[model samples]
Target: MRKILIITGNYGEGHKQAANALYKVIQLRQLNYEPIIIDFMEVTHPLLNPISHYIFINGIKMFPSIYGFFYRKTRAANSMSEILNKINNLGVSRLLKTIKEVEPSVIVSTFPLAAGAVSRLKEHGYIDVPTVTVITDHTYHSSWIHDNTDRYIISSEYVKEDLQSLGVPKEKIAVTGIPIRPEFCHNLSVDPLRTKHGINPSIPVVLIMGGGVGIIGDGSTTIRALENLPKKVQIIVVCGYNDKLKKQLSRELSNSKHEVILLGHVDYIHELMAISDMLITKPGGLTTSEAVASELPMLLFKPLPGQEQDNAKLLTDLGVAFQAKNTKEMIEVLSFSLFTPEILNKMRGNAKKIHRKWAAFEALDVIDEVQNATSSHGTPMEMNS
Candidate 1:
């Protein structure tokens, strides 16, 4: 059986989640193709990935400004990014060995570092496999563009132009929405979900996602703010893996006015999303894509300084979401926009224009087209590969 190797990393769940979502699509689309997901850093240096994951999660929390500085510094074509990429290439030898062992018919990268490594392998004639990069974020970054990459599956049209400005051929880029879980892509009924979840139809539902690691913030300020709202509302807090946060919210909200549902990490996020009227999140690419797919309006809580900020800006610009500068502003935005059904409906409609329900399947289509072209031409695939 032919195999498709998907490379990802554990810096955050977004890369790994994107890889898993595509793996699901590959499974459904190709009966003969076996999809495998590997943590690239584990393959390169087994001991390093855990340390790296710890540093990444804590870095944002401990020293956000410094982390933000590097994010901006490496966002465009710059010497700093060049130096980092050069440093990263030290692992390419191990990466090439791993690739050879897998012997995948097609390879897709959900992490930029892995993409760079694979590009080096192809450049050195170590492998001739077709390589595609699925960019998990909506923003443009210089590191993802490479001379040898066959195709780019991006989420935004402007990102496609950004790639073109960096000299990538237009045909090499396709503006397919970021891949999400197959469950979110399925058609869902909000009223039925609300009833099943025991959500009151008359009360507006607000969902606060603490992200995969449940680090949105201490629930004190947000909880207090939401409790003070005069309107009757229901708040659903998904604290992901932060057991402490979940317990704190449950204790603090026990006597709260609003109907509160506190959930720990769950596989049924799609179900929670279907029942809610609005999402309060950090605007991670995967979360935002899921929100759009569910037709849920977004209220982006205080976004971090890098890609989260960019993702929030894109959503606000498209009118699907609004960004709040702080807790005060977030409450105010909710008071004004959340109460108005007209504005909420309009935002949902805007989200519809940008949301591609078949993004994973679209990615599969691109891979198939690339393989067919390679078979017919017997050469390195051209644009649109």
Candidate 2:
């Protein structure tokens, strides 16, 4: 079996989520491809990986504005990103060593740092595997740009145009949306999912997510706001991988006026989305794409200032999502549209209009073409049609 190396990191779960989605696609398609997903940080700096991840998680969680500030400052500064890229590329030697060991026929990067290291490998003439980067955010960043990258799988056509403006050849970029779990691509009836989860099938459902690490906090006020609406709604909050938040939310919402189901670290987000009328959450790329695939309208909470802000703008622009900058605005938006079937219908329609459910399969097709055209001597491959 040919191996496809997927290099990712744990900065946020978005990169890892993208990697897992592509891996699942390879598995289900049974395409004679072995998808090897590796945490680049673990391979490059094992001892420091966990510590660094802790710092990042806490830093962003405690002070998102600070994180967003840096994200904005460096987002478009390609020339100014050189030092940062060089520091990331310092792990190129270790990464290249892993490449030799894995002997992958193709290399795909879901993390920008991993992409940097792999691109450095190709530029230094150390490796030539078909290299692809699945940009995990809605916005383009200089960290994702690198020479020697064969193809870039991006979120949307607008992002493609932006990359083109940055001088990346049109042929070098492909708009496959963002790869999401294959389960999210399936069509399932909401009534059945509601029954399975023991939720009332007749009532309109609201699903809330805080990204993978549960960035949504207690969300007590959001629930109170929802309850204030005249319409009766059932709310399910998925507190991903955040046990403390889950416990706190559960205790706090034990007597919530609106029916509330607070959960922790669930693998079945597809089912949740299938039943939800509107998803109130932070707009991470993977989650938003999954929501789109499920044709669920969104109520994005105050997004952090980086790619999330970008994601919110794009979704709101497409009319699939509504944004709330704070508690008051969140309640107001829900109150305005929550009881209106016509408005909700419009949101769902807009979601379907931009839903790219087959992004993983499309990306796989490109990767297959790249691999088939590649030379045995590890040289660049002309894309085979």
Candidate 3:
């Protein structure tokens, strides 16, 4: 089997999730391809990886405005952003070593820095394998644009245009939607899942996720706001590997009037999404894509400044999502929407309209095509533009 090296980072879960989705689709389809995922930072900067990871996670939580400022300032291809991308290409030597050891037929990057590093290596003629960069967010950043990248897999045509405006050739872009888990492609029976999870099928099920890092902009505050709703709803919160938050929520919501189920790092988000009448979560690319795939309308809560804000705006414009600016707006939106079935149904219908349920398969097709074309040429794919 030809190896497909999937390079990702853990700064946020969307990159890793996108990588895992590609890996799963390859395995599920029984393709004659071996998918290997590596945390580029972990492998390249082993000692500093943990420290950097902590700062990235906490930095967003502690100082979101600062993070947002940099994120916004670096969106365009300016000299400062160029320097930062080059600086971000710190692990190029280590990445080259990894490529030598893995001998992959193609390199797929879900993280922007990883894509930049691979593009740098390919530009210098260090490696010839085809490179596919999957943009995990609805927005485009200069870091994700690399001259030597063979293909750009993006979530939508809007992003394709964004890249085109940034000078990336149109032929090098593929609008495959953001690849999501294969399980989300199929429609699961909601009633069974609700019963299995000890939830009432009759009541509205609101699924809340804080993304991978469990930073949901004050989970306790959000829950209290939800509890204030006059309607009775079943709330399911997926803490996502945050033990401290889970334990704290457990204590806080123990005496809640409504049934609230708390979970930590569940592998069954598809199931939860299946049974959910609506999702109250941060608008990360992967989670929102999964929610869209599940045909679940979303009440996006306090999206961070950057890709998330872009995602929230896109979803809202698409009519599949509503944003809650703060605790008061969240309460008002949930109360108004939950009590009215037509509102939620309209959003759900809108979600179904844009859902790319087969995005993973589409991405796999791109991977297969790139590998086959390169193999037929008997050379590493080079950027003609």
Candidate 4:
């Protein structure tokens, strides 16, 4: 049986979520292949995991200016590439030893760290596997591209242009939408989903998500804006892993005329998406893809700097979502959107236009291509540095 290694990191939920979606698709195809999923951070240098996570999460939260400085520095010509190569080579002996044992025919990376690690292994002649990168964001950064990757799976056609501008060959990139769970593609009637969630079918339902972290600092502001709307709307606020935020939202909206359902870490996001009329979220790639698949329009609020900002622009350009910089603007946008059926319908239509109904299946097809290329050539492919 052929083996494919799917590598991701826990720095953010998008990479892991994208990796999991690809894993499920490959497994369901039953293609006489074994798929192994690994968190690269966990496997490579355990001592660095906590430090890396802290630097990523808290660095963004507490010191965004510093984070932006580092982010910008890393994007300079070959700066990030050199840094990653050095780190990958630092643990070469251990990493090579691990790869020797696992013997994967193909390597798929959802995180930049994995791509860098695999590139190092290939450069050192330790592994001959075909390497493919599924960029877990709508935009491409220099860090995401490595010299040793064979192909790139990206989210939008616009990203294809971005990669092209960065000197990546057009042939090496495929716009596969963003890989989301197959459940998002499943057809669930809105009425049934509303009934299941105990939501009123007559009133429009809005889903407010702050990604996996559960709470964005702007949650209160967003809630207040929604509360100001003239129409009584049902709001389902998912505060992922943040109990304090859940309680706060519940307490704040307790006596309001609008129905506010406060939840913490729910598994059935697809059901919620199915029932929701629209989404108010920060534009992480995976969440955006899921929203599109559910045919739910979005009002993106206060995207964190870097990739999210890029994602927001792409969604806005596609006419699938709106960006609101502050609470008052957010409320005005929502009020106008909710009251105008044509606007909502147009946004939904645009979302469907860009939606890849078979993203998971298409990703599996790319895996098959890699497998065919590996089998027929029996030679390791090289990516230009």
Candidate 5:
């Protein structure tokens, strides 16, 4: 069986999630191909990976300004960003070894660092395998671009234009909405999901997600603000992996006027999303993509600088979501949406227009196209090797 090596990282969940989405679709549909998913950092830097990952997660939380500063500085392919991209090429030798071991028909990268590494390999004429970079965010960051990458799987036409402005050929980019889990791609009956979750079908259900680190806002400020909305609504807060935040919210919202369901990390986020009318999230690429897939309108919280901000801009520009700078703005947006159901319906319509529910399948088709085109050139290996 032919293999597809999917490289991802754990610095953030989006990268890993995007990679997993592709792996899942390939497993479910492509019987002739085997999908191999590997955490690039783990294989490349086994010892320092964990420490660096810890620093990365905390660095964004403790000093978002600093992170945003760097993110902005590196948005374009300047000398500084190029130098950083070269620094990201640290594990090329190990990566090349893995490439040889796996002998994947095509290589896919969901993490920019891994993309840089693979691009370096192809640049230096070490590997002839076709490479596809699935950008996990809607923003145009120079880090995700490389001279040797054969194709770019991007989120939308906005991202396509952003990349084209950076000098990447438009033909080289495919606007496949960021790959989300297959479950979110399908339409489920909302009444059944609401009943299953014991949610009131009569009131609006707002699903709140802060990504895995729970970076929504200070403790329960956002929740309290939501509870105080003039219209009574059911709030489902998914505090992913943040035990402290979960416990704090549990204590604080125990007696909320509106029904508040507080949960820790959950695997059934798609189900929760299906039942909700609106999503208040951090605007991470994966979460927003899932929301769009569910046709759920969104009120993005004060997004951190960098990709979160960029993602927020894209969603709002597309008319599928609203951005709130703080709790006050959050309340305002929530109240307005609650009072105006038509606006929510319009947003859902916009979401339907752009949402690529089968993005993973579409990405697989791109991979197949690239592989076939490469085979036609007779450069690397045989198709049935």
Candidate 6:
């Protein structure tokens, strides 16, 4: 069997979710491949692991504005290549040693850091495996489009254009959309899901989420806005791992006439999406993709800086969603649209039109091509940009 290594990290759920989707597609196809998914921080350097985790979490917490500023600046800077090169030199030796032991025939990286590490290894002749990067966000960051990568599976054509503007070869970019779990691909009947959730079919259902961390800016205010909406709408708020927020919401919404359900870290978001009339969320790549898969339109709440902001713009531009920067605007938008069945149906249609459900299969096909070429040569595949 051929060995394919998938590298991801826990910086956010998008990378891990994308990697899992590709893994499922490969398994379902029975492609004669052994896929191993590794979180690079777990295997490469133990001492640096915690530091990296802290930097991701605390950086967002303490200096989100500064982080966002630098993130956007890096995307437009000509010196980004030099900066990546320096970071690559510092980390590539440890990563190369680890890859040498695994001896993967092909590599798929979901995180830019891992992609950069593998690119450096290939550049230095430490590994010859063909490396494909699946960009986990709608926005194209310079870190994601490395010189040594063979192909990039991006979320949209906008991202492809962004890469081309940065001088990446057009052939090297594929707009496969973001890969999502196979369960999300199934066509679920909304009536049954609504029945299961005990939501009234007559009432519009709103599914609210704040990615994996469950903390959005002004979440309390958002909840307050929901309370003031038409009482006929039922609300399901997923506070992932944010127990305090869940409790606060539970307490505040205790006697509300609307059927408000508060959840903490659910494994069945697809079911929720199926039953929802619209999703109120931050436009994380995975969350938006999942919403599209379920044919649910989005009303973007407070989007975080950097990639999410770009994601929001892409969705809004596509006419599949609207953005609300404050509680008053969110309520105004929801109030006017929640009861408009025709408008809601059109948004759902737009979502289905934009969703690429076969993205996982397309990604798997690329992997198979790489494996076949490598096996024919009796050597690890050499990547060409």
Query: Which portions of model 4 miss their true places by more than 4 Å?
Result: 84-93, 376-385
Better of 1 and 6 by TM-score: 1
Spell out the clash pairs found in candidate 5: none
Off by over 4 Å in 2: 217-227, 379-385
**TM-scores, each model vs. reference:** 0.94, 0.94, 0.96, 0.92, 0.94, 0.93
Model 5 RMSD vs true structure: 3.3
Candidate 5 lDDT tens digits, 311-352: 998899999999998888888888888668799899999999
State which candidate, 3 or 4, has the greater TM-score: 3
Judging by TM-score against the true structure, name the best candidate. 3
Clashes of each: 0, 0, 0, 1, 0, 0
Local accuracy by lDDT, each model: 0.83, 0.84, 0.88, 0.81, 0.86, 0.82
| Predicted structure 6: clash tally | 0
Which one is best on lDDT? 3
Instruction: Looking at model 1, report the run of 10 residues with the lowest lDDT sum.
Output: 376-385
RMSD in Å for all candidates? 3.8, 3.9, 2.9, 3.2, 3.3, 3.2
Give lDDT tens digits, candidate 6, residues 1-385: 7778999988888899899899988889897788889887776656788888878876785777887887877876458656854754564555666566677788999988898888877776767788899998888887787888988898888888888998999888878889998888779887877878899888888889987777666566678667778656799999997888898888888888788899999889999988888899888898898888788888998777889899999898887888998888888899888889888888888887889878888888876775666653223334332
Off by over 4 Å in 6: 376-385
Question: Candidate 3 lDDT, tens digit per residue, 1-385?
Answer: 7999999999999999999999999999998899999999987788899999999999898898998999899898788898897677675677788787888988999999899888888887778889899999888998898889999999998898889998888989999999999999999987778779998877888889998868898777777677787878899999998899899889989888788999999889999999888899999999999999998989899988998999999999999999998988988888888878899889889988889999989998998888887863224333322
Once fitted onto the true fold, the runs of candidate 3 whose alpha carbons sit more than 4 angstroms away are 376-385
lDDT of 1: 0.83
Lowest lDDT block of 10, candidate 6: 376-385
Candidate 3 lDDT (Cα, 0 to 1): 0.88
In candidate 1, list every pair of residues with a backbone clash: none
What lDDT is reached at residue 142 by model 2?
Answer: 83
Query: Candidate 5 — which residues are off by over 4 angstroms?
Result: 376-385
Writing each residue's lDDT as its tens digit, candidate 1 over 35-83 gives 8899888887677778887888988878878888998998886899989
Cα lDDT for residue 162, candidate 4: 84
